[model samples]
Target: MVTRILSENEQDLRLAGEIIAAGGLVAFPTETVYGLGANALDPDAVRKIYEAKGRPSDNPTIVHIADESALKQLTWRVTPDMQRLARKYWPGPLTMVVPRRDTVPNVTTGNLDTVGVRMPDHVTARALIQAAGCPIAAPSANLSGKPSPTTVEHVIDDMDGRIDAIIRSTPCTIGIESTVIDMTGELPMILRPGFITREDVARTLGKDILVDPTLNEKPEPGVEFRPKAPGMKYKHYAPEADMIIFEGETEAVEAAMDEERAERESLGQKVVVIRYSQEDTETAAHEFFAALREADKDKADIILAAALPQEGIGFSVMNRMLKSAGYNVRKV
Candidate 1:
């Protein structure tokens, strides 16, 4: 398929929306990450998203809405807790999983009775959804297990020919997937962490929050586990090169990187080093995926990265990093 690159103009946006309305895939930007989208109400359209990304059906897609009123059509019931979260974090990087209405296809919800939904803050994302006249079920616009695309170029890298069209726009601001919270239970549980920290949600609803245990570490060596949301059951946000992480005091980690770089250079191996200061957690969050893509662009044989402090948004960054490296870490 010849994939067309659509610019962020009225005509282009309309064209992208028309493709979506017609049950074709369109990759567009959101505040969190670029998402490859299809009409959420169309199961066949939603299937194309999985085929395009080679994503497993068990890993569900998040439904993107243009407005809060659209939630009623997708979910069975919207409780007061759901309303508080929507008011606080909608039009931003937060996904709420609630009981799905019969209208929401089992395929879109990964055969579960619940669906994850969110309203993106990006103007073009909202415009495309409104023009399409339907809620869009989308996942990060990258090949399954590869780094999530944050820029139009990155989207083109993994999805240009695979998808119907791409809406070229500004780089994603949050540069990661949204925080996913499950609202089906009385005590809200966070299935994934992102820029919206635990404190942010707790403070908003004035109640304690429960976090999914799988987010911090993998399940037992031989335990059976199934993830309820995307990015949980799969090895995601990885790059082409083999990535290894060095964790320790800042000075020691940097010194180990220097030594490794020298050794690899002597062996005529291309090396990419990604290290960020402890205070640069926000910057790390923004550039982590892009840096992985850069390493791939350089055709690096190996990638060596310094671990982010697992506090604040760094937890999200570390989560992606560990997965990208396949949990290959050495404490220096």
Candidate 2:
């Protein structure tokens, strides 16, 4: 299958949309990450996404819309609080999971009764969706269990020949997935963390938001747990090399990394170190996945990362770091 690399011009955007309208795959950029998109209303089209990325069928995908009014067609109900959240964060890095209408295919929602939806804050992404003329069910464009693509090159690295086309654009501004919140419960619960923090959502709705325990605690060994959203039940955003995170005070973590670097280097191992202050989460979030990809590019034998404080956006960055390290964190 030949994959066409399309520019961000009007003609190419229309071409990308036509591919989607024909039940074909198109990888396009969003503010958060590049997403492999298919028409949400078409089950066969949605299945192509899973096959291209080798993603598990049970892992749900998020539906991207061009306008707020489109939500009426996809969701069964839209509450007052849902409207409040949409008003505040719809065109940003936030996804709300709500009850799915019959029109949404079971394959798209991973057989769950609810579906995740978002309105991206990128012109190219919105334009492509508008051209497609239907809600797009998309997940991160990269192959499953690898780092999510933030740049067109990253998308090409994973999906070049596997998908139909890629809408070339600027690197993603926010280098992580959106914050996924389940709106079906009594209180809105965060299933995945992203640039949008819990405080931001809490402030928007004027109430406390529940953070899912699984966000901090991995499921027990040999446990059968079904994820409510993407990045919940899988080892996602991982690099090829083994990774370990050092968690503690900055000085202690740095010292531990230095010692580990020396020890590994003595054994003729190539080590990569990633260090960030707790307050510098914005930079961390923007560069984390790319750094992981670079480490793999360098053929690093081991990757060492410094831990960030588990609060605010720092908590969100740590979530990805912990997963990339396969929860192999050491308290220094």
Candidate 3:
């Protein structure tokens, strides 16, 4: 199937929407990452997304809405806290998992009772959703378990012929997926970390939030782990090369990376080393996935990445870095 590359104009946006309304797939940019979108109410359309990405059916997709009023149609219960969070962080890089209404297909929710929903803060994304006239269920447009696409080129690299159309727009501002929080509990628990930090959510709700242990540690061997959200129970955002993360003081980590680079070079192996200041988590978040993709483009044999301190947005950046490295962290 030939995929149509659409511009971010009114005419092309309408065409993209028509494709979605007709139970077809389209990849469009969000502030965070490009999403493979299908009508949330159409199970068959939603299934196409899983097929295109080779994503596991059991992993859920986030529903993107154009306005706040649409939230009530998708979710059964919207608590006072949910409203407050919507008021504060709805049009940003944050996803709240809430009870799903019967209208939302079980396939979209990954056979779970809840669904993740968010209102993206991008004009093109919102315009496309508005034109489609239904909530859109979308996950990152990249192939499953690979780096999320932040540019139209990255989306084309993975999904050009696999999907119907791709809305070419500016590169994503935040180069990672949105923060996913389960709002079913007494306090919101973060299932996936993104540009939105735990502190930001806690401050918005005036209470402390919980972080899933799996974010920082892998599940035990031989245990069946069902993820509550995306990026929880998968080897996501990984490059083609062997990757290792070094965690410790800046000087020690840099020295260790240098030694590893030299040793690998002596063995006639190509190596790529990623280094960033512990305090610059925003830049780290914006560039982490793209860096992994670049390493793959260079055909590096091994990738050595500097581990950031797990605090604030740094904690969120580490989540993706650790996963891309497959949790191979060495502390000096």
lDDT of each: 0.91, 0.94, 0.92
Q: Write the per-residue lDDT of candidate 1 for residues 1-332, one digit (tens) a residue.
A: 99999998999999999999999999999988999999999999999999999998888999999999999999879999999999988889999999999998888989988999999999999999999999999999999999999999999989878989999898998898899999989899989989998889999999999988777585456775556789988888888899889999989999999999999989999999998888888788888999999999999999999998887798989889988998889899
- List per-candidate RMSD values in Å: 1.2, 0.7, 0.8
Top model by lDDT, which number?
Answer: 2
Q: Candidate 3: which pairs clash? A: none
lDDT of 2 by residue, 266-303 (tens): 99999999988678899999999999999989999999
Residue 44 in candidate 1, Cα distance off native in Å: 0.5
For 206-299, candidate 3 gives per-residue lDDT tens digits of: 9989999777786677878667799888779999999999998889999999999999999999999998877888888888888888888999
Question: Where is model 3 more than 4 Å wrong at Cα?
Answer: none
Q: How does residue 12 of candidate 1 score in lDDT?
A: 95
Residue 332 lDDT, candidate 2, scale 0-100: 88
Candidate 1: residue 181 lDDT (0-100): 94
Rank list by lDDT: 2, 3, 1
Candidate 1 weakest ten by summed lDDT: 218-227
Clashing pairs in 1: none
Which residue pairs collide, candidate 2?
none
